[model samples]
Target chain A: MLLAKIRGTLVSTQKVETLDGLTFFICEQLDIDGKPLGKYVVAADSVGAGVGEVVLYVTGSCGRYTDTTTNRPCDATIIAIVDMLDVDGKTVYNKTDDA
Target chain B: MLLAKIRGTLVSTQKVETLDGLTFFICEQLDIDGKPLGKYVVAADSVGAGVGEVVLYVTGSCGRYTDTTTNRPCDATIIAIVDMLDVDGKTVYNKTDDA
Candidate 1:
């Protein structure tokens, strides 16, 4: 899994049939320090995360493991909304601080 | 799936039991224009790609769908050796030419 920030929502009606009813979000990859990596991914939303929320996402076929994306061609899926991130015993990000 | 160049092989004696006997390779991501993208991945080799070969790799759970990686914890797998790459009606790379 990797960390990202939900940047915005994406709505596409002309997508593959299996992806219908799944919400997509534009996500910007985040480094461990909660800084943007300048890379982005369009991911299916499984956790109902809002824009500006840091999230944990899984890519590749593992993205299909979630109920909303099961057996779909979705390559990225938001699996969890991060509450806090700690690395090396130091707090790197906390949702409360941003909220 | 993505394009990558096989840079070298990897040998690990202390790895997860499921990953034992699997051959790993160091791969460098490649752009559509056949240029290096400055990113790298350690991938399990399923296609017996040699060093310096351009290969196609699959990440996530799909990496485990192959016979050699089935039910393994692998996140990346080299699935195919690329003979040529074409984009926008132009040949971007040809393995024979490189050879």
Candidate 2:
């Protein structure tokens, strides 16, 4: 899992039928300090995260292995909202720092 | 399968509960002349990508294995939609030049 920020949204008109109701968001990978890493992804939002929200996302197969993505064409799903992140015993995020 | 770009998008509403209408995007991670090597992701669109376009994603479990991401819970789902991408041999992208 990695820390990232919600940058924008992606809109697709003609796509797979199963994707019909599914929403897609534009994301950018972030560093430990919550800085833009400069990579992009379109993931299935399993958690209710909005723009500018610092989120925790899973990659590879874990991203799609959700009840909502079952048998759906999805990859890179937001698994949690990430209230706080501790790396090497350090508080990278506090959710109260006022971002 | 690396090379990526997209900017943001993440909207969660209480999450889980089978994730109502799965969709998330906010990616970063690009090189190969595309620039922006930041880290970020949240994907689930199978095609028809917008927001600066330039898409192509896949992760761990084949980005949810396709067929609409079998077994719910997705991973990383954009299986196709890259008009032209070639590494080593050159030509990173060629949807008709000019990005």
Task: Identify the candidate with maximal DockQ.
Answer: 2
Interface RMSD of each: 10.6, 7.9
The local distance difference test score of model 2 is 0.64
Each candidate's number of clashing pairs is: 0, 73
Indicate the residue-level lDDT of A44 in model 2: 68
lDDT of 2 by residue, A1-99 (tens): 877787655544445666567655556788988778876666668777776777878766565588767655465788878678788999988887846
Instruction: Give the poorly placed runs of model 1, Cα more than 4 Å off.
Output: A1-59, A62-99
lDDT of 1 by residue, B1-99 (tens): 566889988887988998888889999988656678899999998766789988766677766766678789888877667666543345667777889
- For candidate 2, write residues B29-80 as lDDT tens digits: 5654567776767776556465555566776566555555555565655554
